[model samples]
Target: MTKRDIFISLALMCLWGFNFSAIKLGAMQTDPILLTALRFTFAVFPAIFFVRRPPEAIRYLIAYGIVFGLGVWGMMVWSINLGVSAGMAGLLMNMSIIPSLAIGYFLLKEHLTPYKILGAALAIAGLLASITITDGSVPLKALPLTLIAALSWSLMSFVVKQSKTKHVFAFSVWGMFFALFPLVLFVFIFNGTQPFIDLPSQLNSEVWFSILFQAYPTTLLGYWVWNRLTIKYPLSTMAPFTLLTPIFGLIGSIIFFHEDVSVLKLLAFALILSGLAISQWRPKKVEITSAKLKSECK
Candidate 1:
C-alpha cells in the first residue's frame, strides 16, 4: 500500500471503530431497526442515482441487501440496544471470520490449515469467556443476537463471492437498496405506525449527525476505499489491519461511553485477537539466513 492508501485504510478503521458508538447514539433515540432502515435509505438515494446498478445481479442484490442490511446491521444495532456495549459489539462482529472460514472450507472447497483450526479453538474459548462476563455489558440474549449478526456478515461475504461482481462499490450501494426492505418490514411489524409517524420529530441534530456519519463516511465512503484497497492488494495484506478495529473500538468506548474494561474482558480480547492473528497468518517469503545458505552451499 502507498502511504496515501495506508493512511486511508487507517482512517477507515478509525471510522468503523467509532461506528458502533454512532449506532448506539441513534439506536438510543429510536427503534434500532427503523434507524437502520433510515440509514440505508439515505445511503442508497442520490448516490445510487449516479452509480449504475451492478449488472446481472438481481438475485445476488436481493440476498446481499437483506443479509447485509437487516441480518448484519439491524441485529447488531438491536444487540447494542439490548445492552451489549459498543466495544464488545465491535469485537463480536469480527467473529464473522469464523463463519466465513467455515463457509469457505465446507461449501466453497477452500483449504484450511491446522493453524486456522487452533485459532478457531482459541477464538471460541474467548467467545465463551465473553458470554460469561457478568459486567452488565454483555446481556444473555444479546450474545445470541450479536452472534447472528456475525453469521449474517459471513453470509453476505459468501453472496459477494458467489456473485463474482467486479463492481463491488456499486453492488454494495445498490444492494443496500434491497436491505431497506427487510429493515422497513421489520420496523413496521415491531413498532407499527408509531416509529414512522414519529419520524419527523426524531430528526434532531444529534440523530442526524449519527445517521449521516454512519451513512456517508462509515458505509459509503468507507466501503468504497476499502473495496479499492482489496482489489489493489491481496487479501492477506488487507486482513491484518482489521485487528486494530476492536482495539480502536475499546479505546473509543472508553473515551465516549466510559465503558470499563475488566481483567476477564482483557483476557477475552487477548485470546480472540491472538486466534484471529493465527488464523489470518500467511507464509512470508523465505529469505535464507547464513545457516540456511551454508546448508545449501554444502
Candidate 2:
C-alpha cells in the first residue's frame, strides 16, 4: 500500500472504530433493530437512486441483505443493548475472522497457513480470557449474542464472495434495500407499535447524530472506500489495518461512555489483536543461492 493508501485506511478504520460508540448511543435511545432500519433507509435513498443493481441472482442479493443487515449489524446493536460494552462488542465482533476462515477452508477449499492457525489459537485464548472477566461489560447473554453477530458477519462475507459481483457497492445498496422492510417488520412484531408511535418523539439530536453518522459515513461512505481499497490492494495488505477498528473502538468507548478497562479485557484485546495481525502476516521471502550468501526479496 502507498503512504496515501495507508493514511486513508487508518482514517477509515478510525471512523469504523468510533461506530461502535455511535451504535451504543443510538440503541440506547430506540429499538436497536429500528435504528439499524433507519441507517439502511438513509444509506439506500438518493444514493441507491443513482446506483444500478448488481447482476447477481436475486437470491444472492436477498441473502446478502439478510445476513449483512440483520445478522451482522442488527444483532451487534442488539448485543450492545443487551449489556455488551462498545469496546468489548468491537473486540468480539472482530472475531468474525475466525468464522470467515472456517468458511473459506470448509466451503471454498482455501488452504490455511500455520500463522493463521496459530493466530486463531491465540484469539480463542483471548475469548476464553474474556469469559473470566468480572467487569459488567460482558454479561451472560451479551457474549453469545455478540458471537452470533460475528458469525453473521462471516455469513455475509460468504454471500459477497459467492456472488462474485464486480459492482460491490451496487450489490450492497440493492441488498440493503431488501433488508429495510424486514428490519422494520421485526421492530413492529417484537416491540409492538409503541416504539414506532414514539419514533417521532424519540428522534432527538443525539439519535439523529447517531443514525445519520451511521447511515452516511459508516454504512455508505465507509463501505465505498473499503471496497475501493480491497480492489487496489492485496487482501493481506488490507486486512491487518482493520485491527485498528477495535483499538479505536476501545478508545472511543473510554472517551464517550467511560467504559471500564480491566486486566482481563486487556488480555483479550492483546490476544485477539495479535491473532488478527498474525493471521494476515506474510514473512518476506529471501533469495537462496549457493554462491551468494545474502540477497533481499522485494
State each candidate's clash count. Answer: 0, 0
- For model 2, how does the per-residue alpha-carbon lDDT over 116-220 read when each residue is reduced to its tens digit? 777777777776676577478778877777888888877876777677778878987999898897888888889988888888998999999999999988988
Candidate 1 residue-wise lDDT at 180: 88
Candidate 2, residue 26: lDDT: 87
Instruction: Predict model 1's lDDT versus the native.
Output: 0.80
TM-score of each: 0.86, 0.88
lDDT of 1 at 117: 72
lDDT of each: 0.80, 0.80
TM-score of 2: 0.88
Off by over 4 Å in 2: 1-9, 227-242, 286-298
The TM-score that candidate 1 achieves is 0.86
